[model samples]
Target chain A: MEGTNFQRYLARKKAMSAYTWNEVKKHKMLYLFLFPFLLIFATFTLAPVGISLGLSFTYFNVLEPPRWIGFTNYLNLFLSDDIFIIALRNTIILATITGPVGFMAAFLFAWFINELPRFIRAFVTLVFYAPTIAGSAYLVWLLIFSGDSMGHLNAYLMRAGIINSPILWLTNPDYMMYVIIIVVLWMSLGAGFLAFIAGLSTIDEALYEAGLVDGVRNRWQELWFITLPNMQGMLLFGAVMAITSSFAVGEVTQNLAGFPSTDYEVHTIVNHLVDYGAMRFEMGYASAIATILFISMIYAKRIVSSFIGKIGR
Target chain B: MIGAAKKDKTSASGRRIVKVSRAVRKPNRSLGGDIFIWGILIIFGIFFIFPLVFNINQAFKPLNEIFIFPPNLFVINPTTDNISDLFIIMSRSWVTFTRYIFNTVFITFVGTAGHLFVASLGAFAVSKYDFPGSKFFFGIIITALMFNQYVTAIPNFLILTQLGWIDTYWAVIIPAFGMPLGFFLMKQFMDTIPVSLVEAAKIDGASEWLIYWRIVLPLVKPALLTVMVFAVQALWNNPQSLVIHTEQLKTLPLAISQIIGSPHAPQVARAGVNAAGLMVLMMVPIIIFVTAQSNILKTMASSGIKE
Candidate 1:
């Protein structure tokens, strides 16, 4: 009986190996086409992700060998790092402020465009979207808040007698966060606006007429019953896009606010990560912060998706 | 046909009556809303376009004129001296501006082509083929879409370092070749293509590659163009990525950043140069978009996909 079982196991193993070889032979061309893509994807996308996950457990500098420090980095980040705490608070603040406001703006713009004549809509959309293709949209904000009396906004305000003195828009600790938020809202308006406009276009006009017949008396009722329901998936997708963008607010924060905010008011988690990980070479600690960020985003995404799913159904 | 024409005439007159009633409700008060709408839109438009206008205005002014009180709103007397000076600086600088443009064009073109090819192939496979793990792969791609570039920054840097691909075109082009977002767009677009065509092509002795290259590609040209526009914008504006590459192999965006950092950079001239750089960067995409606006919008509408 033992000899028979051993022979059966050997036969099964041989069959499994043969099956694998057959897969390779049958899909050889497919494999060949996919090879280069897989290599690059693994190298750039998958490998980096794996390494970051691993590094979240180790203490390393680019200059020295990584030490397996386990979860000490995470423990220290949670308990000890005051800056990390500030970054988390500030990033949440910025995201909360921008996400809803930006979404509403995009929605309103899209709705308005949908109501306009075709040529007018096309021209206006182009005008609104043109700034995105140009790299200096943020630079435009920089000029407006140039920190000097000569700054365009300050100049206009002073000329109009709104204030006797120029406000230090970029330098003030209290107002700097607002300034960054405004710039982000302005720059991000284009993409979200485009998405909303696309969503609005997908909504069937018959649904609105049907709502009217069903006693949807006003614009609000029509929107709630017809437009919103019809465009639920797009709306959810837009929300996800907005959330991702709000969390990943790096370039504007870095460019406008610099390293730390004037009073540690506007420094986001991403900025902190760059400071510690890239500049200071604290790989383990930065990884911990990043991992926390990742987990929070995942959690937030779950909440958002659930809310959207409820509305959609 | 007579009944349809009669119904259309009645509806047209009904619309006119509705407009007249709306106008009569409160002429001044109703005008207020119209004014308010235009007012807000105009303010926002100015807000958006003012910087580019300001930059262009500043570029034509002399260095001393840049810091004038009230900030010169427009150029009264423009000169070619700034342009001449810009050329002289470009000629003297070790960094070749022309080469930088070439590098940018090459990277954008190759990366766009690579993305179009691979993304279309991958999209076609997922959209058309029924295979084990296809759904799983699709889910993985969606999850990967949520992974921001910043999250992958350090690890990608390390990987690039390991592969000794730093400062090479491969570092930029290869990594960008398989964008999951582009793949998603393509798949969504291709799904709209009828399945009958694929079977017909197969019956006619066309291989999958031939079908993809011939039928599928031509049918999805508008999507491909839209994706191409997105790819160009991303590559063109990508200074942060290029900074990780070698200094000498810098693209135009990185070059602008470098010029910004230089000590001898003139304030007024810098604005102009940035304006010029922006104008140059935007020109191609804008022209492509404008010329293909109807086609792109129609395609986007049909596919029901958003970036």
Candidate 2:
């Protein structure tokens, strides 16, 4: 009986390989089509992650060959690097606030605009999307949050008698994170937001009608029963977009608050990574930083996906 | 609420009458809810639009008006002098302004085109076919979407150095081809296309390449435009300063920033020119988005993660 069972398992494995080989042979042209992208992707996008993970355990500063370090970077990151702790904490706060807020705002605005007529919806979308596509237009935020009395926010506050002196909105450590949050949220209505608008529009109108017939007496009830469940795919997508962008909030801080921002108050993991990688050429340490961020993001995404999977259930 | 429920029930029962009346199916939206939503939208609209308006207005402001106390949102004495000054500054740079434009336009065009072509081809194959490892390949792409460029910057630099692509157009354009967003979005959009359409093409004895290029590509125009817009936006804004070290190799955004001077530049004198340069820098992506947005919306309609 044991011999027969082993033979059966071997037979099944052989059959699976044969089937896979046949599929590969039949769709050989499709592989050709996919080759260029996969090659580039493997080199640039995929390999980097693996390489970064590997390099995280080494010590290299680009000029010298990498030396095996054996978790020294990770140990330093957690136990000794006070700045890394601040960055990690700041990243968590930024992601926690902006991720959910951006996600909800994307959904809510999409739902709101879904009720509008055709052309108006398109125009409103442009209005919402302007902040993102207007490349470097985010520099406008520096003007608004400029650290001087002549700055827009400062001028307004001073006029309103809300403050005795101008608040150095960008430079002030106390106000920096809030200013960054406001700017990020302002620009947060991005691709995910567009996806939500599209998702809302694509949700079958008949489902709402059917839902109404089934005693879904109000818009809110209809939404919970029909709309949310229908667009769970988009909710998941939007959430991922929101979470990833929220985690990668270095550019806003770098540009607005200035790099190595005001005693590293607005420093994030990405900034820390950039600080080491670009400025300092500490490739191995930066790779370690990148690995932490990559793992944390993947972990965050998994949690979000499980939660989104249960939405409207 | 009771009256509406009664009406709805009657309408459901008298289906023919309901069909005519519900031709314009405005769902049961309360006046208060409508007001509240509109109010919120308007407030958010201001929040979204005010900064952009202020920025654009600054481009038009005369030098003195730019430095006015409280910084007026509207420019009273608008001038094209700043725009002219921006051109003069660009011309006086060590590299010709057209050289920078050529570099940018070349990079943007090649990068966007290559990305769209390669990504869509890959997307089509993955979406329509189920060859061995197709699912695994697609899984990687999805996972790639969960992170951004920051995480990969270090390894990417090393890899580029190995490839001898640094300090060349390929450095900027090549990596863009691997940006997972376009491929993911293309696959999502392509999934909505009927499999039967491809089967029909196959029955007509059309080659796979022919089917992808001629039949399916045309059908997914919205996705193509959507991807193009995104690619263009990214490449256009990409400061080529990262890998391309040569002054002549720098892109438009870098050139524009130079003319705009630093954020620390004396704001009173440079404000008008700075604003003008920024406006010029921003216009390309803005214009591209505005033109392609309707198509983007259409493409995005189907761009959802499959459970």
Candidate 3:
């Protein structure tokens, strides 16, 4: 009986290989079409990621040969690094706030815009999308929050007697996180938003007509019965984008508040990684931070997907 | 079975002309609702619109007007001095200003085109085919989509150096081709295309490549253009100082940053020059976006809440 079972297993394995070979033979043209992308993806993307993962456990600082030290970097990062803790805490706060807010805002605004005439809809889309496409335009936010009395917000507020003096908006740790969150949301005009707009447009109008016939009387009911269910895929796409972007809030914070903010209050996990990776030349530790971030994000996406699945059920 | 779904799909979900007419006819249908929606839009518009307005105003202001106690919102008199001064300041650089434009345009065009074609093909394979590793490749891209793009920069830099791509255009454009967002997006959009459409093509002896190129590509043009807009936006704004090292290879952002942030410029260090540079950095991309705005906006129709 054991010999027969072993033989059966071997035969199954052989069948699988033969089937796979046949698949390759049949899809040769498709494989040829896919070849260039897979080559670049493997060489540039996959290989580097794999190498970075390996380097995470080492002590290489670019000059020296890598010395494997197991999980020392990870241990230090979690157990002892105070700045890392602050960054981690701030990142979670940012992700929780901006992720949901941006995701919902994208869908809601796109849905609203879809109600307009085509020409006006296009104009409105460009207007809303201006913030994202306008690179470094968020620097205007710095001018708004500038410490000088000449700053726009300060001047207006002072004229209205809203404050005694110009506040150190970018510097003061108390206002740093709030200001960063606001700027982030302002610039949250992203690919996902455009994708949502496009997604909303592509939604078949007949679905709404059928829903109206099916007793979907008001816009709200129409939205629920017709729109949301249809946009389920795009919703998932938006969520994935939102999660990645919200977690990657370091760029905006570093640019606005200045990297290594006063009291390090505005620091994020990506900033912490940058502080190690770019500034300190500790590639291993930086890779470790990246690995943790990558894993955490993947897990976050899983939770988001599972939670999204439960909605509208 | 596929034929039945195809017939039903055309009858039930084919473009609804009546629904569009009803929406257009109902313009004054809800005054209060319009006010609410427009109210929200106006507020968000202020947030989104301020940057473009501010840049234009700042560029035209004389030095005195810029630092005045109560800042003016719009320019009273627009001048060409800033533009002229920026060109003069830029003359001091090692490379010509046109070289910078050429480099930027080169990278943006090549990067955008490469990304659209390659990413869509990758997406097409995963969406339309089933092979041993198709599921795995799809899973890989999804997993890739989960992480921040900036995470592997150091490793990428090291690999590029090893490939002798550190100072070349390939260093910039190659990695962009691997950006996973377009792949994810194209796949999502392709998933919306009726499988029966592809089957109809297949029944006519259409090869897989032909089916994808002709039948699938045209159907997903909006998504293609949307992805193109995204790729263009990224490559256009990409800083020269970040990727390439050569002075001649410096993209627009790097050149602008250098002049704007230059500590020891006599005339160019002024805020006017900075404003001029900002406008320059901004206008080209804005013009391109405005030109291609229709194509980009086409994605809006197909990308939204689907049935």
Candidate 4:
């Protein structure tokens, strides 16, 4: 039966060539609409991704020819580079702490704020979202944590006699991770937060009424019964975004804590990739780092999607 | 048969009891819950506003106030000298201040408008059409979303150089058409449009283009507006975009970062100047946020529910 089915599929394919051409002709308008995007994407995005993968297998520094040295790059990254290992560990830790925490905070804030009467809710949303929108928002945190007597946080701490001297907030490795994490969380209430608010509104009011009628006692119960089940799709989207951003979190560290952070305490995989790619001209090694980062994000997305798939089931 | 009949009867009876009781009750909206919600709202409000307020306040602070023994959170004596000097500082450079603004606006408008059409067209094709390999195309988009864009930056730059697009607006503007987020969001939103509407148009002899433009595009207006907001944000905030290398074409954010990052951007006025730049950098986005505020919220409400 299987052999016959395979034979039939092959026969259909051979017969369908002219017929498929007609179908393709019928859909020419869609193809036309799709052309510009595909053209640019093929040239820039798809081609570059392929290039990065190709480069990952070779030893290339722009001035020299790309020497094919497959798997050695990967092997070196795993075993020889202690810095990559530290970066991997730090990235995992940061993701675990902030990813889920920020996700929940975003949802909770959006949900509660949504319950407010109209105008005030908009005002509040703007307030919460402003920091993320402010392009140099992180610069403000840098100022607050500046290792100067005049820094606001330091001035307050000194005035209150909490410490003897102005602390090196960004420089000190002991406080670096915490400071970066806090600042990240503060700025994390961005598009995803707005997404949750929007997602909440899409849920029908009739569902809530029906849920209460079925003996739902309070807001929490209604949320568990009706809201979560209804917005599973949005939740999944938010979770994927949250996980991606969480893993891709070296920028704040690069900005706040110096890049080769004191003993590389705050280094992330992206920073390690940049260290090779940008600072050094080892394009092949950087590509290898990027490949690993790419693979990890895909893996993270898979795990997150599967987990979200189980929500409200 | 008897046992099955008895089970069905009991379950039906139970369902009736639920329905009858459900008919008696109304949805609760307690004042106490409202009060508690407001309390939490106020706390998060303060937490969110402090950094923004401080940054804005710095725009008006004197250099003395900026570096005082105990730095003032609120400006005691506000001044416009810094704002005037920000212009003076830019005038000293090869690119004038207004030129940066023009470059930024031009790039942002062209890039954003291009993305709006190109992305939506791609999205419309995927969501509404049953063309061969459509699934594969969309799958590639999903995969693209997972990967960090920076990983591709080097190779993309190399590609641009090969095409002789280096130091050109085409290098920047063309790639904006392919942003995965805009495509993803628009496609998801378009998916919700009813097939019957398209079918009805087709029955009335509407061309595919007409059906798309008149029937489908208008339905996803909220999504389009939201994408516009995002496109503006992405183009405006980036001081680090690699494409624009020519001094004549430097955007506002790049010039602003230069002003802030320079060691000798007039020392006494550096803080004030930096603050003024920060304000300018954030101003347009803030205005957009305020103006399209509802549309943004509406888009968010509809988004993130689909894979």
Candidate 5:
């Protein structure tokens, strides 16, 4: 029995090696086609990630040799960095506000479109979605909050006698987070809205018919039992997108709030890392922050996926 | 079916009577829904268009008029003075306003074209070829999609620096070629194509290249256009990457930033510049989107892909 088992093991190894070689030979052309892309992707995407992971454990300042520090950067970031904490807080705030609002807005817009006559629905969707292509959503907000007497929002406020003095909306730290959140909602509304619209379009019309037959009356009932359940995948997808976007909240903050808000109130984890990682060249510390952010995103993703799976099932 | 038809007919006549009575009682309700839709649409339209309109208005207005009380919605005398001044400030030897435009156009075109080629080929491989590691390749693509650029900015910068690629168009165009989102969208669309066609092509002894070019390429036009729209928008709106390599090469967003950050940066007129820059940057994408709007939406809706 022992001799036969050894022979079986040897036979299995030979078969596996042959299978591997056969796969290599059969797909040789495909590999050739994929070579350039794989090369570039490795250099650009995979290699950087691997390097960053390594650098997270080392103390490197771009100019000096990378010294092996072994989790010191991570420890220091958690223990001593006040800015990182502030960044984490701000990012959470922005994400928390933007995610739900944006998701709801998109879902509603999509549902509204889906309910409309087919041709008109397409036209309205195109128009509603045009702002996304226009790339001036943030610019519109800038016009509204120009921080001066001639600014549109301030001008309207003054005319209405709401306030005697123009409010420094962008400059003031108190309102900066709100301003960023509003802009993010505006910009993100288009994409997520479109996603939800797409998701709504996929809900088997038969499901709605079934709901109607079962006496699922009114918008709320239809939404809870029919729409929401059918759109589970999309909701999960949108949530992941929102979370990732929240983590990477740099552009609106940088553009509208400007760098280092009054007391760093508007700074996010991304902004902090960008300042240190790119500007100041603190490679080790920046990598640590990035790794933490990445891990959090993965955790969020798992939770979202599980939630989607439960709903889908 | 007959009972439902009878019920529909009864409901229609009953609704007609109610509609007549209701119209008599509340005339406005007849137009109320239409009015409400139009009102909402107009308000949102204005909200959407105001920045571009305001900026265009500001760009043409005299610098003094830019800050006029109750800021002019309509510029009385639209002039090129600000634009000419902008040109003068932006011009340095061969690098002029026209040069900036040229640089932006060139980068956008090259970047979009590169993305189309590489992403399509990669997508075709992943979708059609039952090769070993195809799944692994696709997994990598999806993983890359989730890997936020913000997190990878440091490592990407380090790699670029090591390669001495900073300040070069390659720094922008090369990396953008393998857009994972574009690849994924294309793959999803390509998956719907009948595999029998590819097999038939193989039976004819056609090379993989010919099969892709002749069969897969034509079949995936809509997806290609979708990818094009995405690529153009991404490259055009990318401001951060431009910041990394800021020396000789300047894209539209970066150019606008330079104007904003310049010594003569008009405090109030900055709003106008912001608007004008965004408007100009947005024009190309809007035009492309309008031309391919139907195909784009159909592909998006049917394929269930999002950026």
Candidate 6:
């Protein structure tokens, strides 16, 4: 009986391999098309994450060969590196504030502007999108939040008797994160915003009429019942964009708050990673930091995705 | 038979309940609601456009106007001096100003084209055909969008070092071709194209490559254009700080920021020049976007992330 079962298993395995090979031959052209992207993606993106994860378990500083030090880098990160905790806390705080708020703002703004005339719609889209695409637009913010009276916000506030002196907005720990959040929110209406706009437009108009017949009383109800359900896919996409942007909040903080801002107030995991990886050349430690960030981002995505699944149900 | 009977009974009751509760609800565009929405939009619009307007105005402003105490939002005595000064500053750099422009243009063109071609081909195969690992490949692509460059930068650097691609334009361009978002989006858009259309071409003895290149591509022009906008925006704005180190190979944004003396430096004298440089940096991508705006919207209409 055992010999017969073993023979059956071998036959099944052989059949599966034959089936797969036939499929491969049948779709040979498809594989040919997919080869370039797969090669590049595996080499650049997939292998890097795997390599980074492996490197996180070691102690390497680039000049010397990586020495195995399993869990030491991670242990040091959790216990000894006080800055990592602050960075973790700050990243979570930043992501929490900006992610959902930015997502909602993008969706609401896109929906609102969708009802406008075509020309006006395009113009409004440009207005919302310009700050993000503008490579050095952060310079405008630097001037606006400049530490002196010459700064626009300070000048206005002082003239209005709101404050007596310039607030040193960027460098001040109390206000730095807030400034970063505001800038983040400003630029958040990006590709996701455009996607929402397109998604909103694509909803079949006939559905609204059908919805009215089914007792959808007002625009709000119509939206909840029809629009939300129809655009859940776009919402999911937008949520991913929002989560990624909000979590990877590094450059804005650095650009505005002058790298390693006062008290490490606005220090994020990415900033810490850069400090170790680029500045300090602690590749192992930086890889651990990156691993932590990657895990948290995936966690956030999973939560958001499941939550989106329940929308308008 | 029993299950069918039960389903009928429940559906009948459901219909009755819906009918009983149904009201004569007008699809009304209330005046108050319109005003409220428009009011909010106008406020947000101002918030959005304020910086761009300020940047543009500052670029055209004379040195005196740039330093005005209140920082006038509008320029009274606009001059080409700031723009000319930006040119002068660029010319004085170790690398010629045109070299920077050429570098950016070359990188942007090659990167955008490579990404679009590679991503579209991958997207087409995955979307149109039922290959063994197609679903798994696409699943990875979706998950890939969850992290940004910060998480991948170090490992990417290591990989580039291994390939001996560091300090070359290939360092920037090749990696960009692997950006999964474009693949994800193009697949979403491609999925909307009917399979019958491809099969029809196939029945006529058209090769898969010919069908994809000649027929499938033209049909997905909006997606093509949308992806182009995204690719252009990314490559055009890329500072390429991680890989490329040669001054001659550096792009426009790096050069502009260098000339403008880092935003951290409180140089009052360089304010107008900074604005002019920023204006130049910001406008190219925006112009490209404006031209492709309609097509992008059409493409994105089909860009829903399906489970």
- Candidates' DockQ values? 0.28, 0.60, 0.33, 0.39, 0.32, 0.44
For model 3, how does the per-residue alpha-carbon lDDT over B138-200 read when each residue is reduced to its tens digit?
Answer: 778777875565677778878887898888999989888877777877876787789999888
**What ranges in model 5 sit over 4 Å off?**
A1-17, A119-123, A135-137, A198-237, B1-53, B72-94, B240-248, B262-274, B302-307
Pairwise TM-score winner, candidates 3 and 5: 3
Which pairs clash inside model 2?
none
Lowest summed lDDT across 10 adjacent residues in model 6 chain A is found at: A215-224
- DockQ for model 5 equals 0.32
Which is better, 1 or 2, measured by lDDT? Answer: 2
TM-score of model 4 (CA atoms)? 0.91
Q: Please provide, for model 2 over B37-96, each residue's C-alpha lDDT reduced to its tens digit, 9 standing for 90 to 100.
A: 678888998899888888889999887888789778888988999999988988998999
Cα shift from native, residue B241, model 2 (Å): 1.2
**CAPRI classification of candidate 3:** acceptable
What is the DockQ ranking, best to worst? Answer: 2, 6, 4, 3, 5, 1
Ten residues in a row with the worst lDDT in model 4 chain B? Answer: B1-10
For model 6, what is the alpha-carbon lDDT of residue B80? Answer: 97
RMSD to true structure for each model, in Å: 6.5, 3.0, 6.7, 6.1, 5.5, 6.2
Clashing pairs in 5: A106-A193
Each model's lDDT: 0.70, 0.86, 0.78, 0.81, 0.71, 0.86
Model 5: how far is A184 from its true place, Å? 1.0
Instruction: Select the stronger candidate by TM-score from 1 and 4.
Output: 4
- Specify the CAPRI tier of model 4: acceptable
Tens-place lDDT digits, model 3, residues A65-104 = 8899999999999999999999999999999999999888
Residues B1-307, candidate 5: write the lDDT tens digits: 2323343444455556434665353211223343444556557656555655566676677767776788667788887777566555567535566766777888888988988888888788888988778987887776576677877777888788788888877788888886677877788788879999999999999998998899999988988888888888888767655335554577766776566553223455454554444555666666787787766755555444222
lDDT tens per residue, model 4, B147-262: 56667877987788888888877787888888887888898888888989988998999998898889999999988998999889888887645677788888888887788773
DockQ top scorer: 2
Please report the candidate that would top lDDT against the real structure: 6
Per-residue lDDT of B98 in model 5: 73
